[model samples]
Each structure stands twice: as C-alpha cells, then as structure tokens.
Target chain A: MNFAQPVYYPKADYIETDTGNKVSRRATIAGPQNIILGGKTIISSTAIIRGDLRRTGPGHAVVISLGKYCLISEGCILRPPYKTYRGNFNYYPMKIGDHVHIGANTVVEAAMIGNYVEIGKNCIIGKFTMIKDCAKIADNTVIPPNTVVPALVLFSGSPGQFVENLPESTQELFESQTKQYYNRFQPLEG
Target chain B: MAPIKDRFTIHSKAVVCQDVDLRGEITIGSGTVVHPKATIFAITGPIVIGANCIIEEAVIIINRKKEVMRIGDENLFEIGCRVECPSIGDFNTISTRARVHYTLRLTSYCVIGAGCLVVLPEEEVLEEHTVIYGPASERRVWSGRGHIQELDLRRKHSEYLRETLPKFNRLRRGDGA
Candidate 1:
C-alpha cells in the first residue's frame, strides 16, 4: 500500500479536550477517534462527552462525531452508544453534522443526526433515533426510539409529531449562523 | 412513611431530585420537579406531567381508572391542594386547600381560589378566579341562583358585604389583567 500523507487537524476552529480533567472551551477538533469534536466546537461547562470507543464492539467503535461549528450547550448528555429497552444492546455511534445547535438539558442518544438541526431545551431524544438534516425539534419534546425524522421538518409535542417543513433559505440561514458561535469561544472564560 | 411500590417508571433522563410519592403509570417529563411530600396516584388512568412543572408540597394529583390526567408546563400546584382534574393547561395556578374534582379541563393561566371547590357539576368552564366556598353550594357567582345557604350572624353580614362588592374579584381581576 502506497503511503499518503495524513491531513493533520484539517478544520480551523476551537476545540476543548476533556480526558479526565475538564478543558471546557468553545472550539472544534478533528480526528477519527471517539468523540471527534469538529475543529472549533464549543463544549460548555460540565458537559461530559463519554467518547470511549471500548464501550462499543471492536472495529465498529463508538464515537460522538460532532460536525464543524456545532454548539453543544451546558448540561447536555450526548451518549452515542446508549442503552436499549431490551437491557442488552446499546445504540450505535452518534453522528452530528455541521452547524447544529443543541440547547440546554437535552439528552440525545442517537445513531445519526443531520446538518443544521436545531434541538430546543429539555428534549429527550431516545436511542437509535435518526434525525434528518435541517430538522427542528421544539422544546419539551420526547422523541421515542427508532424514529426516522425527515429533512427540513419541525418536530414538536410530547411524543413529537411532524409539524411543517422549513424553507430552504431559512435552513441556509440557520446553518450559516453557527460559525459565529464557534468563533465566540474564548479559552480565557475558563 | 409507606411502602414504596414500583408503579411509576421514570426515564433515566428525568431529573427527579426530591422524595415524592407516586403510584400507577405516571410519566413525568424532563425538568419537572415533584417536591417532597407531593403524592400523586394514577389509580385509574395515567398522570402525565409535562416539562418544567413544579408540584409543590402536600399536593395530591390523582386520576381515577378509565380517566387520563394531563398537566402542562410551568404550573404550580400549591401546598395541600387536592386535584383530581382530567387536564390542566400551562402556566396555571392551583391555590392551597382547593378541592378540584371531575374537572374536564382548565385552560392556560387559570387560577383557582383557595378553599374553593373546582368541579364539573355537569361539565362547565370555571374561568379564571372562579370561587366556591361551601360544599354542594358551588355557584358561579355569589348570587342567590345556585344553592346559597344561610350564613351565621357575623358571616351573614360578611356575605352581605360580599354581595355588594366582591373584593376578591376586584383583587383577582387585577391579577388576571
């Protein structure tokens, strides 16, 4: 196999490292390992990213792949391999695409998340849930497991029902706004 | 202290910090705070409380079999209120010692007076600041339309003054406005 030069730290943004001691910052990180924070993503105070690959099976290890310019707010739990109802199998790795905004107190244990997704406060996204790109989930929503959310759709309510689809221009605006959030993270705030 | 039965199954995401007594299939939403000594039982149907609600102390939220109870967010069920209503809207307030029974639904921002009886004699809407003093004499207003029992000497004088100008209505109307 011919050797190709590896691209080191591809994305430009802020990223905070949380190994054991907390290095909370609004930054992004890039890597193939577990808990790959997109270069320049802000992980707020007391935010725990349990990106241990050993929890999942070997080779297909677990990872919290947060995309570029994503803001995971305070007190949010983004567990990639979450426990299932059967009490045996855990869910797969969580894939959060670029420009996603996750509010406070949201517990998301899902397999995939699309780009420009905005999840409001106090929402509990069940395990193995697949959120389509540009979808909006309102506050206080409880999205059950195994849900296949469509693109540009609005999710609201207790069990969460499809409200309406967002326009393309609005989706673009939402996606572009998170870059400013990534830039605002000052390491001195610690 | 009573026996702790495994009736309610709270999700791991729910933040239930205080010690409260709950029975039957009660699903408390995320960020809901059930204060200490608040007892809730869904003996008949399920009691579903939405997120960000505060159930204060000594409040009992019970639902009989075949009847479901739903509560919206940011509601405060004050101390010692006995609520058996089927549904209550968001941002509502239930005052202390109020007896709510057979209530079909209470809309948002509605207020129940203290020591009052909020019930459906035959499914009626008791709008904001609705009050009822005596048992079985649940009148819409303090007029002689519904069962108005005679009061004692001091209470009769107070009743006369109440008929002229319901001061609580004036004060509570200020609250509603």
Candidate 2:
C-alpha cells in the first residue's frame, strides 16, 4: 500500500454530532490507521494527530489513538507510534483523557493526562510529564520532561510549580468547560 | 535615589532572541545583548534599556506603571538576575547568583555580589564583591532559591491576562507581512 497519499477523514461511517459539525481534518500525516472515538470527539482542521511514519512490520501500521470526548485545538501536534516495538522512542502512543481542552499551538508528548485538565496556549508539555486530573495549567508554562503534577492543582511558570490548590470557585468552571468542549464535538450517531 | 521623570530611549540594534516575548512600550538600546530564554514584559508601563548592556540568561525584567525597569549602559545582569523594580543604575554588575527584588538607585561603578537579595530602597555604595541583603537579614548567609516559582505563575497568569489585554500588532518588517 502506498503510504504517501495523505489520509482523509473517514468517509463511509462516521457518527455525526447534532451540531452538524463533522470533525474537520486537513493536511494529515500517513501511518497505520488506529483511531478511537467515543461520545463526541472533534478533531479540528490543520491538526496533526498520528503515529510515526517509519516501517513497523507486516500487519502493523501506525497507531493514532484519541480517547472519548477529547478536543485538540487547532495547530496542536500529537504523535503516537503505530506499533509497540517502535515505542522505545519517547513520545509514542500519546494518551489523552476525557474532558480535556488542549489549547492552540500547545505541543503535548504526554503519554497520559488525567481527566478534567485545561492546558493553555503556546505551552509545551514535554515527554513523560504526567499531569493529574482537575489540574489547570496556565499559558506559556513549560512542563519539562519527567515532571509529575498532582491532581486538582494550578501550575504556572517556565519550570512550573504547585502555586495553589484549585480554588472552589473555579472547580465548577473547569468541570463545565470540559463538558462544553466535549459536547461541542460529540460524534454524530448513525 | 529619587524617581526619574522621563523614559530612557535605546538604540535600535538591541539583540532580543530565543523564547522571549517583548511587550508594551519599551526601548532597547543598540549593542545590548538580551540573551536566549529571557523575557521582557511591560504591561502597565514602559521598559527602557541603555546601550552596550548585557542581560544574560533567564533574567526577568518587569515594571509596573509609574515603576518601569530602567537599566543603564555597560551594566550586566549575569545569568538569572530578576530585577522586578526600577532604580537600577549604570555600570552596575549584577552577578549570576543575585536576585534584586526592590528598587535600588545606584551611581556608576558599583557591584551587587552573587546570591544577594538586596532590598534596599535607598541609595547605597558597594565595593566590588560586597554582598547586600535586607537589613533584617543582614549577616545571614545568602543562598539562592534554586528554582524559580514565578515563571510558572507568570505562564499561568499570562493566559488569563492575554485574553483581555490589548493586542499589539507586531510591526511586520516587510519580510513576513
């Protein structure tokens, strides 16, 4: 199979959201097709979410997995590997959780992010940095490699620190924001 | 020292680069080296830097309105000096291990030693290598904060602030416009 042809949005059977918005896909990478969509997940145009572009083996292609109700903003880059053997490279099998809003131009190499997380724009979440659930990270904050963020906290800065706990007033805001994002891109049913 | 009346103008050949965001009305002089990974943000006022100065790595120069970060020529912010207040004077050599948090208006040919957290609001004179600190913490052994906490706070804070802040149209220099 020629892998040079750019992959297009699934044409035959894609559940459409009630908002009449099909997940827009433009200028994507080539690899093994491994996509997982649950509830309402909208992948925006000009967003690159896929696995590596190298040869894995027979019966194995690249694997790009998106969880249920994950909204990756425009210009976001998510690179997951197609096979487990190629997982030795740092940022393969990128895992994102439910009710997450990744801002524009944010580069996430995170293997996993807990639910209810809000990341700001121009931020770079480096490899192996696990941000726990209900954590709100401020914009331009760089989470360096091998950093562990505890749950329900607010992190900001170049190196990032636990400035304070998530205030009670902002908890509802965080929860509702995640729900709104997920609701906006819920996949349409057949 | 006393507060000045006007903004300091800089030459246009200032070297500002690498992961930096220069904001608000600020003037950077020619031959000034604002090194890689440095940030200069002026939200409420203007930032003025003089000619022939060197602002080293990871330095943060911020000024509130009515209190701008006014830096002088040939002075050096050597590696990680965070001057949040104005009143830093000319020919001052702020070492790598120093963090000046308060307003300090010094004359030319002075030195702020490394690992010093000098908070003197009044004018003072220091010989080269003289470490200064708060009067209450005088004679205390100076140690650095090791890691910066405000960078993350600033990153998180900039998110909320930028949403409502006035967007300054970066003048496209005819190359990418």
Candidate 3:
C-alpha cells in the first residue's frame, strides 16, 4: 500500500509503443523482432533485453516472451540461458509471465519466470533457473544454475534458498502493485 | 555531453555488437565476442582484450589508471559485471554482477563468483587458479590440474558466439586490420 507519490519520467526518454510498452530510448534491445511484449511493460534506461540469443539451428524462434504489466528496472540485463548439450551449444528461449517486476541492476538468465513474481534489486537469477508463480526473491540474492523455485515462496540469500512460504494473498498483492506501478509512471508535467 | 573519441581496433573475426559503447583506444582480438550494451571505456589508457573472450551484455570494462589494461585470452565477463582492474590474465571468469576493483590485478584462471566484490586496499596481484566467491568474499585456490574441461567449455562457448552472433545481431564495422 505504497500510495506515496507517482514517479515522473521525461517523455522524451521513453517510447510508448502501440501496446503501451514504455521502453526507454537508452535501452538496448537486440533483435526486437524476436521479442514479444504483451503490453504495459516498462523497460527503464540502460536495461538490455537480449532477444538475439535465440536457439541455434532454429527456424525463427522467439527468444524472450514477456507478458503484461512487467517492469524491467534500470541497468537490468535479461539474457537467455545457453548450455552445451550432446557436444552442441544451444541457447534456450526465456518466458516471463504477467505482473512480474524485476528490480534494478538484476541480471536474469532464467529459462522461465511465472506470474506475479517479484525479483529484487541486484539479484542474479542464474542460468536455466525456473521460478514458479508468486515467488519472491530478495535483493542481492543469487539463485544457482538450474534451480527451480516453487510457488508462493520467498527466496533469499546467495545461492538462494527458500526462506519462507509467502502469504496466500501474494498473488493479489503483486498484481495490484504492478498495475499501480504502471499507472503511476507518468511523464513529467509541463 | 562532449563527443567520445572512438579509437577501436577490432579484429575482423571478432563479433562486436553495434550497440556497444567503446570509448577511447581499445583493441579487441580475433574470436572475441562483445555483446550489445557492453561498455569498454579506456579513460586513462588503452585496453587490449585478447582472443576468444566473451563479454556479455551490460558488462563494463573501465581503465581509469595511467597504465595500459591488458586482458588475456579466453576470458569470460558475464552479464552486468564491472571490471576496472589494470590487468587480467588468461582464462579468467568474472561472473554475473561481480565487481573487480582497480586495485586488484588478476592472473590466469581466476574465477570471481557472482555478486562478489574484489576491492583491496591497494594494488594486489591475485595468484593463478584463485576463486573468490560468496557474499563474504571468501578466497580459495582451485587446483589447476585436471581443470582443462572448464577452459574447453569456454572455448566452445566463445566459438559458438563468434559464429552465431553475427547472424542475428548487427556487428560493428572494424576500422582496419
């Protein structure tokens, strides 16, 4: 319930797409055609979305598919996971569900992140990590590679372990928070 | 803002994305892959990155000291990591969100784990096979014997990036040989 104040950004800095995606002009999005943003997504300044890292030997695969009301804060890097399988290197596609909020300076190399997930500032979601719905990761947490986080849990600390079960109301709270954040992000008044 | 003088000498075989902000004099060796949004700022001196290095997205390599910064071959700078060190030897891996302060000089086969900060009081050179990790910045020396597998993996990874990245992303045009 942080109804404190609305944050205003310079209108010149962001490009509001047809689907209401407010992407900063400074954000470097590689391979825009391979990324699908559902809508109302805010990609702040210096955030990099690596959609060019698609699967090899593929016929036009989608690299990063993000759902509605997602927020990629400043200095965040979102790159798809890759691995050597059967003596061949391959990059996997990353999927993020709705109302997901990734904080500032976070580097996410996850395979999948489910709905209503809130990842805190400076966190590193490791390679091929899968996060279930309504999961929350605290600031400076480093989730290990191939770790699977269960639903409705709070993950904290380096080599992030499940600290506690989140309240059942987490989904509703996260949804509202994301929606409010999107609404409150307005252009500076003249 | 004043215009930045771009003095970059990228090898023809290297894959440096067009979106990378390369300022001052920098030399990228053959088989190196510099991903988009990676920043290489040589403020005080030149930076020479060796062959088969992988500089992932948002990685920042800054040379703020007077001496030249020389990074050796087969290095991997993972996403969002910051390197301000003056010298880094071959086969080092600086993982995600890690910070290598200007005071530390890394020798060959060092691994700075994710989110770790290497900030010594003054200039210190780390020995080979040093692995600095965790929130507490614990230090350990990995046995160099029987560890050829990691370097092999890195070589394969960089080779894959050098081949596939140009097919998807627009590469920065190399000035000269």
Candidate 4:
C-alpha cells in the first residue's frame, strides 16, 4: 500500500480504450512507473504487481511486461525472481505473452510465460520458471524454481507433472473466450 | 494512563508505517517492519510480535474473541493473507492470500503454502518442519530443518522495503538503516 490513503473509486470502474486494458482500482501495483502492458488486458481487484523490486545495479530495466489479451484475476501476485550474482542480489525482468489467463490467488514469480497459456486458481509458479506457449496448468499446481513447462500440455499436482495434450481447438477457444470476457467485463452502465 | 490508551504500546526499533490501522494493545518487536495499509486489530487481548518479522501490505491479522495472540521471530506474512491464528512459532512462511484460522500452536519450520486454508482442529497438532499445502490439503512432514533460503528472501525483501518504502510512506520508528 502507498502512502496516499485510497479514496472511493467510481463504482462502475475504469477501462483504457486504446490498449483496451481494464485495471481495478483495488489492485496493488507497486512501481507503476516500471510496468508496461499490452492491449486488451484485465487486471482484477487484489492483483499485486511488484515492479518496485527491480534489478540491483543501475540502468532502466523493464520489470514486468505483458502482451495483449491477458487476464490476471483476484489475489494474484506477479513478481520477478531474485538471485544473488557477484555478491549482489538482483531481481530480473519478467515477460508474459498474449492470451494468458491467470486464475485467482496464484503467486507467479516466473521469468517468462509464453502465449495462449491458462493457469488455474491457487497455483504457485516458482521463480525463474519458464512456461512455453499454449500450456494449461490445472488448479493447485506448484511449479518449482528454474523449472521449464513445455507447450500445449496439461499439467497438475505438486511439482507440476504433465498430464495430457490439449485439444486442437485450444487456441481458437482461448482467443474467442478472452475476447468475450473483455467485452463482458462491464461494471453495469448507469 | 487510561485503560483504552494503555493498550497500544510500540516498543523500540519497530518500524510501523503510517498507513497501518492498529487497534488495541499491539506490541511490535524490535527489527520488525509492518508495511503500509496492514490492518491489525486486537479484539481479545494483547498481540505481541517477535523481532525480525516482516508483515507485508494488505495483511489482516485479527485476534477476534480470543485471549491472546503471539507471533514469533523471523516470520514472513505475505501480501493479502488473512490470519486469525493465536500462537505462531518461529520461521513459518505464511504465503500470499493464505488463511490460517484458530491455530493452537504452529511448530517451527512449517511452510503454509500460498492460498492454503489452514483451519486447525482443537485436537490437531502441527509437527515441526510440516509443509501444509494444495487445494486437496496434503500434509508433508519432514525431519530436517526448514528452508533457510526462503526465509532469507523475506529478509532481503524487508531490506528492500526499508530502503524504498519510506520514500513513499511515512515510517514511524527505527528499523532499517
């Protein structure tokens, strides 16, 4: 929480037009100065993005960057992984690709998340973990640090074991469904 | 001192941010950092916190209808976690958004996973180095010590917050350099 006491936001909420990004006022985004978002993204209430934890050394490093058509649900924390290098512990940058939907209460500290991925609720994606494109992580999945998840595979359980291959229609389905959600995420027009 | 005013006493070397909502007798231990917007309400009795603990933002720690609440040293209460536990042992990692309710005694080196709902029964007793996690509520007991690396991360985070957060929020007392 910042120093400024949060006032009452509009009941209906806010949405960006050009990028089509919808961010809830209740979301705690630390260092909004460093975050970059692509078009048509939805960040729900209670989502936390820790951009304040940046690299140790100087130079303007991008903390977190998201691609188009992403949805971050409630109580999710998006933070970069930290590691000690040359006697200095630094937090590297984190990048996410397009059409990703991260479900509620998920703690993500991954280095890179690929496109068309869907992560379910209450999952923990550990630091420096790289997720390839079109993966589906089931609910309560725990992917350990430095782990790599391949594309188009369904994964579950602790330590995130692969379960099954996704359907052929997965890409089309996610694209269309996320578009629908973005269109339907209105706060009830007055 | 009046009874209502005597309940709130902040000890030395405790850094509580100006934005915190504290009600009743809450004793903050030395080297502990309570971040901004952390709401801690003591309804039953006094709440005592040990040293070197970090309480992050939006964390609601309430002692409702209970006798006393005591938190241990070197513990990390992550963001958005709702805790109503009575006695918490040292070095426990209560992760993000995890709800711990009515815990009698949590042994040391226990790692409660993120988003886990831990409601301990009166008869249940948590062993040391117990990792409680998953939506299915799996319990994994270990004989060895806890993850010192994970605890170290919190210290690093607290150090970072100590350097950075005061630039944004108004800090109350002595904490980090």
Candidate 5:
C-alpha cells in the first residue's frame, strides 16, 4: 500500500467544515441539508452524494448518514436505495458506519454499510444490499441486489460471492488505515 | 476553430440541475430529470431526449455524428454511465458505469447491466428486451413479457425526482420552455 506517500490536493478545491469534514468543490453533493456527515470524513473530487432522493411526503428526512473517518474516493457515487412499499415508491435512507473506505469510481446503492469495511475500486454495490462490519469487497466486484454480506469475510467476483474469511485484526487495521489516509490527505503548502 | 452554438430546448416541467454540462443543440422533453454533473455534448449533431428520462450524475451522452441522436421516454441512465449511441428507444435502463459505444442503436426494454461495455461493430442495433450483463459481457433475450412494472417504477422515480430535486438544488432555467 502507498500509505506512506502523502497525497496533496489544491487547498482551493475543498471546503473544510467545522467538523473536520473535507468536501471537494467538484463533488456533486445534492441536498447538503439532508446529508449527515460525521467528523473527519473526506469526500474527494468527482464524488456524488445524492442526498436529494429522500423519502417522499410530509416533514424532513435524512437521506444519507455517514459516520466518522470515512473516505469517499474520487468519482464514487453514493445513492440511497429506493423501493416500492404499499404501491407507493419511496427512497430509504443510507447508513454508513465509521472507518469505511470506499475506493475510487465505486457506485454504492447499499442500504447499510457497517463499520471498518473496505470496498475496493470500480465496484458496483447493488440496491438495498447490506454489508456488515469488517467486510472487504474486492475491486471490480458487482454485488447483486438485496444481498447480505456478513462480517469478517472477503467478497469478490462479478456476482460477489464470499471468497474467504478475513483476519480477526481487520477492524483495527481498517481503522488505522482510514485514519492514516485522512491525515495524509493534505493540501500543498505555499 | 469556430465557436459552437448553444441551442437547448427544455420543456418547462423538466428538472435540469444547474451544474449539468450541456453543449451544442439539445432538446429535452417534459418530465426529464437531469442530475448534477451529467454531461450532454452534441458536438456534430442535435440530441433529442424524450419525456420522463432520468439522467443520473456523471452520465456522459456524446453525439459526435452529423445525424441527430434521439432517445425515447422512460429511460434510466444511471450514475457514471457513458452513452455515445446514435438512437435509443423507450424503457431502457443503462446501469452504473456501463458504456454504450457510438455505433450501436438501442431499442425498447433493453437492460445494460452494471459495468458492461457494449462495443459492437459499426451500425449494429440492439434488439428489444435484450439483457446484457455479467463480467464476460453476456447477451441474452429476456423471455418475460413487457416490463410494465419496471417502466412504471421508472416513471414514478422520475416524477419523484422532478418534484423533489428543485426543492433542494438550483435549477437551470431560460434554456427550456
């Protein structure tokens, strides 16, 4: 891993919120009011968070709730899953736990992603899929709709079957890696 | 190089986000919901999209040929999909990160699966209800009857977005009716 290399971005391209969430200017974040971001999350350029697809009718609703120290990489699209209930179509909120690292160009439509999960590049997480804690989804994996990925396993391939069990220390490893990635993502000094 | 003319005709009921990148001549029919960061580049032709289409974020539709590129109603272009096809019929779903090359013509009820790349020979046409999916880019004919439920769901999705998106994001006006 290129963990030691510090990735520098232009300071003008990002807006750093008070909660230490770094959101890129080029990222298309629709309905910022409906998105709840925990502290120290990094939303890279070209990442699209569709918070506007909230639940229909009456009162306000939270569309996407992301936890702390998450890394949404470049070109990643995060859209909440939607389905028809009682003959009326509605969108459900997406919940993502802490220390989750979503790789570049991955389109995630999952209902929930648990803590310390690492999803690799170019993966398509289908609608309403549930990924539990400490799971590792390999690059280019296409998970089918309504699939449940249990904890501590590595999922790969087009249909995204379980490949093998992950190490017990995966949670610690992912937490440290995500924290390190957030720290190393800095702007070049003048 | 000559400056390209910007001519867009969007219906008043269409909800196009302000951040969408549109160039050259384009016509968007009513009830189309174009999300932010979607790009429609008509470099050498006029592109016409029919009613109730959902153009999701980061979708790039480029028309480089001299002939007009037309797209029918109730089509769903999901996030990060690229389409350079000549013409497309109704009720098509192009899933996330799929690429349809310029030489193909797509018909109604065709489902292009996620991450699939359709790069057929020149002037090739995709038949109706053709489902292209999997890592090997498998092709199959869907034996089910007309996708009435799916199309109805798509229409509902588009309607919901049209009603909800403008409430949260800035709309691009003055280019459409």
Candidate 6:
C-alpha cells in the first residue's frame, strides 16, 4: 500500500512461459489460449493483447503469434485483423518474427512483421500490411493498410511511407537490444 | 477488467464499465456512461463529472490541480482522449486521441478534434464553440450544430450505452460496482 520502497517483488513481476517468455502481471492478455508467444519475449504492463479476437470455429488457429525475443511495450495493442468476408466478419492471424520490438502505445494490426523489425512509439501499423525484415518505423508513424514495407527500410510520418534503407547492421542492433531488454525486465526487489 | 475500486461516488443511474481504473476522490453524475478501460485518476484533486456524459473506451480524465476538476453536463469524450484539465464546461466533445493538458479551461461547445494536443499555457479559456484540430492545436472557427443538439445526441448515446453496457458489467451506485 505504500509508494515508497517500491523496489520489491513479492512474487514474480511476470509469469514465465514454458518457452521462457515473460508477460507482465499488469498487461491485459485476453484469451491467452489463442496467443503464441515465443521464448524470451517481453510484454510490458498496460499492453493489450486481444487474443479473443480470433477466427471463429478455430482449431490450431493462432490469432497472434510473436516470435522469440520480441518486445511489446506499454499501452501497445496487438489485435488480429478483422474483415467482412462472405457476409460475416472474420479475423485473420497476426504474425511477428523473431527479435522484433514494438514501441510504447503502438497499435499493430498488421498481417505480418518479419524478423528484426523495430517500431517506434505511438505508431499505428495499419491492418493487413506486410513489413519485411530489418525494417524501422519511427515514432507517431501511421502506416496505411495493405501497404508493403520492404526489407531493411525506415518509415516515418503520419501515413507511414518508406524513408530510407536501414543500416545493414540493423539486425545486429535489434538482436542486442532484445536481449538487453529481456534481461533488464525483471521484478524489483528490496 | 480490474476489481471495483473503493472511494468512488457514482450515481445510481451512472453506467461505469468493468475496466475503469480509479484511484482517488472521484464522482460521476447520473446517466453517465463510462466505457471500458477509461481511467479517472483524482490523486491530486477531486474529479466530478456531471450528468449524461459519455466517456468512450480508453478515455483518461485526470485531475492534477489544487482545485477540483469540475466537468459539466453532456460532455462526450470519444475513444482514447486524454483530459488532464482543471475544469471542463458543458457540451464539450473531446474527439479520439486528443490530449488536453493541465489547467486549460474548456468552455461550452468546444470540439477537440482527433489527435490534437492542446497545451496552451497562456490561454485559460477555449471560448464558446471553438474547435482545436490537428497535432499543432490549430484553432479553427466552430460551425454546424448547436450545443443543445450536441448535448441531446450525447445524452441519447449515453442512454443507449447504459442499457447495452450493463449486460457485460455489473453496475451499482457506489464505487465498488
């Protein structure tokens, strides 16, 4: 009940998945049965994962699948894409590859994100977009739906478009940062 | 949704959703519909919302002043709008994703457009029917419908919301709903 001396973790701050992923206690993880988080992934507090928004009548249908060492920051929302097909609203799967980091308050409904992608804060990744590997999306960018972001490019703006090609070392940076974030994300102890 | 918090004074007719996070002294008037994930923090000062207000999903109203953050009747805060103002008058519509900073006095019939950030330190009052749109707080002349019309629309929406939302979340007069 006290604010001071807050450096204490009574239990674990996050629940460790069988694959070594960590999901914060404060994060809203709905219908976890539909979500597949790879090992070493970190989902921060206040993030919302709408795993319940999966395709209806599903067996082995993964609504949201995050690869290993991915980081989802605070207030981000990860929702599968929904579309009206054949007179009914159907949700599609969302897939993210390894070593990807989505920044704070970003909302991602993208169909696919390749490995080593880094999205900055306050981005709105439009539904059904295809983001290739080693891509970097800057803060406050809004990518239009169905837009394809080619590999190793930087995108930034209200409606996100290609800004420049990413450094060849972009993958290395993401790998290091993902591991660093995973290690730093721990329950406080007093 | 988090558990029903303590120290909240909600009217019997107020419809607060399941996931609202309240911390300090907060009060809501009758016929107000607060949707899921709406956060009302009154740690520094009390926040009193007037009647027939519709607070949509993820709307955050915080009071960070020495005085009470008084909100008047028929205010409609759309999805993801952040209100940290000292006082907001009647019939104000804060559109989606707009941020109203601390101590700004929003008068009646002001429409804050989507994604706008309003943080004018000098201007205390957003005069009658003024609209703030765009990320740079571009002040534009207000037009179209009157405040009465706006208030009626919001009230009707709130009425509809009360019936539909109660099906999902338990509603009570007290704080612990």
lDDT of each: 0.61, 0.56, 0.91, 0.79, 0.92, 0.79
Candidate 6 lDDT over residue span A1-190, tens digit each: 2223322233466777788787889997766777888899888888988675556663766889999999899898787765555644466899999999999988788999999999999887767989999999999986767889999999998667778887798888778877776666556543
**Top-DockQ candidate index:** 5
> How does residue A23 of candidate 4 score in lDDT?
88
Which segments of model 1 are wrong by more than 4 Å? A1-33, A53-56, A82-88, A186-190, B1-177
Instruction: State the lDDT of candidate 1 residue by residue for A1-190, as single tens digits.
Output: 2143332221232344542112344321112355666655666653445453224344655367887778777666665543433333343567999888888867677789988899998676766889998999998676767888899899997567899988887576785566544444443432
Reference-based lDDT, residue A170, model 6: 85
lDDT of 2 by residue, B41-156 (tens): 67677888877676644567777556656777667675456776565556566644356654555445455544456676674544333334321324332232321332233222
TM-score of each: 0.44, 0.41, 0.92, 0.80, 0.95, 0.63
Winner of 2 and 4 under lDDT: 4
lDDT of 4 by residue, B83-166 (tens): 887788888878766788875467687877766787766636577888877765578986664366566666776676566666
Query: Lowest lDDT 10-mer window, candidate 3 chain A?
Result: A51-60
Best by lDDT: 5
Q: Identify the candidate with maximal TM-score.
A: 5
**Cα RMSD (Å) per model?**
20.4, 14.9, 2.7, 6.4, 2.0, 7.8
- Answer with 1 or 3, whichever has the higher TM-score: 3
Alpha-carbon runs more than 4 Å astray in model 2: A1-22, A27-29, A53-64, A81-91, A168-173, A182-190, B1-177
Q: Write the per-residue lDDT of candidate 2 for residues A126-148, one digit (tens) a residue.
A: 65678888898898676766688
Q: 4 or 5, which is superior by lDDT?
A: 5
lDDT of 1 by residue, B1-177 (tens): 334333554544344433466777777765565544468888767888886566644578988747668888667675457888788877666754567886446766566644456656676555543444433425443333222221122223222222322211121111112
In Å, residue A38's CA in model 4 sits off its true spot by 1.3
Q: Quote the lDDT for A4 in model 3.
A: 54
- The reply for model 5, stretches above 4 Å from the true place, is A1-5, B174-177
Runs in model 4 lying further than 4 Å from the true structure = A1-12, A15-17, A186-189, B1-21, B35-37, B123-154, B168-177
In model 3, pairs of residues that clash are none
Candidate 3, residue B18: the lDDT equals 85
